[model samples]
Target: MTTEFLSLLCLGLCLSYEDDKENERLSKPSLHAWPSLVAEVKSNVTLKCRAHSQNVTFTLRKVNDSAYQREQSSAGDEAEFPFTDLKPEDAGRYFCAYKTTVSHEWSESSQHVQLVVTDKHNELEAPSMKTVPHVCNPRTAGR
Candidate 1:
């Protein structure tokens, strides 16, 4: 009888441990900017936040800022925040996070990604690659 009681106690402890693990915070989402980390003025980029679950709300925040830059409810597994007409003000360290629509707790912030913006001078096409001249220009081609 003592052996049976000890076995039952072990089972209860195992179950409790599992419950604790289940109650842990949500996993951190992966954040990445498309094309490249460095961007030129008047260019475009997308910051994508990928989470483990769908139907969650994603939030983008620039480091050192008090408020979130953008938030969206994503029905899919990832949320994209597009930055168009890039400017020097938009260049900074950014991170993202997400939480279930029904939950108040937010997942941990994603790894930060820096967006370096170059000067706003008129772009010139490189002498070599003239195909997509507008996209890859002399000023940015070296970057």
Candidate 2:
């Protein structure tokens, strides 16, 4: 009877250990973020992108088929793109993409950002006449 009881206790311990291991595996959650686009005319616009794992390679592509620019996220698994000194010719669709080294999978791109850069001088205002202010005449109130 003593030997039988000891075997049962050992089995219970093994089962508990297995349960703990399973729980540990289940606790790790999946991470991922879709890219987001921002319409900005030069001078730094943050293009947001996220990854589910650590050490992700973030990149930006000019939709007009320009060269791809890589951005590493030291701040986290997210990254941003800043376009400086925006010119009208720089206007185009842009996309953000990220891939995780751990998973080796790339997240779906964020919505396309349509950057429409208009010339500063082209954005002008029409001249307007200034209106003169009139003082309230209390004597004319009753009349």
| C-alpha RMSD in Å of predicted model 1 compared with the true structure | 11.3
TM-scores for candidates 1 onward, in order: 0.67, 0.49
Per-residue lDDT of 1-143 in model 1, one digit per residue for the tens? 99999999999999988777556688999999898878898899998999998899999999998875798998998999999999888989999998885457789999999988876353453344456534656877867
Model 2: which ten-residue window has the lowest total lDDT? 25-34
lDDT per model, in order? 0.86, 0.57
Query: Which residue pairs collide, candidate 1?
Result: none
After superposition, candidate 2 runs with Cα above 4 Å error? 1-42, 52-54, 125-143
Q: What is the lDDT of candidate 1?
A: 0.86
Best by lDDT: 1
Candidate 1 segments whose C-alpha is farther than 4 A from its true place:
1-22, 120-143
